[model samples]
Target: MNFCKGKLRKLKQAFKIIYRQKSELAPTGLNDDLQADVMRRIRRLGPLKSGSNFLMLFEQFVWRLAPVAMTITLFFAIVLMNFDLIPDSEIFQLLYHESDDFSMIQFLRF
Candidate 1:
């Protein structure tokens, strides 16, 4: 535990040093014509192909469908729990009923 704590302290000190030194870095200035040339080259390339477009559309569809999929999964989980679809176990019955007669062997035999 002491070793872990020492490592954590070292990590924190490293991060602090990095944060303190970050401001010393200089920013690169881009020329206005350079930006315009890059944009002109991009515009000349035209739109994406059908395959890339399909992938983008599919990505959007999956993003939109994620919540719906999760909702359906949760709904089914709740339904299964409510319906008691899981097999009854000796431990569960013992916990819920405080019964001593239930045996794991008998439960397994069925």
Candidate 2:
């Protein structure tokens, strides 16, 4: 029982030493020189040029337009798939043509 108590006390002391070592090694704050170097590199790069700015603008435009474009494309696909459901009108006649053998593929080609 005494030997077991001595071993337990040693283990507790070892754990405390480890915890103190870890806390001492941990970073307290950022180094000023490292922060200054990062800022210096950013300054050297400067602002974006006209071409880069235009490219960024174009990217944003495409991002905003993609969903709308996809929705319109999907709507057209659905309508085309159910072309027979569309009421016969001037627009339909113009699109489908008055020919007895009207073909969607041929119309699309034109």
Best by lDDT: 2
Least well predicted 10-residue stretch by lDDT in candidate 1: 84-93
Q: In model 1, what lDDT does residue 39 have?
A: 90
Candidate 1 pairs with clashing backbones: none
Q: Rate the local accuracy (lDDT) of all candidates.
A: 0.79, 0.82
List residue ranges in candidate 2 displaced over 4 A. 1-25, 48-52, 83-110
TM-score of each: 0.38, 0.39
lDDT of 2 by residue, 17-73 (tens): 999999999888769998899999988888778659999999999999999999999
Model 1, range 1-110, lDDT digits (tens) per residue?
35698899999999999997895685566589888998999888877696589999999999999999999999999988788444457457664575467566755675
Count of clashing pairs, candidate 1: 0
Which pairs of residues clash in candidate 2, taking residues 3 or more apart in a chain or in different chains? none
TM-score of 2: 0.39
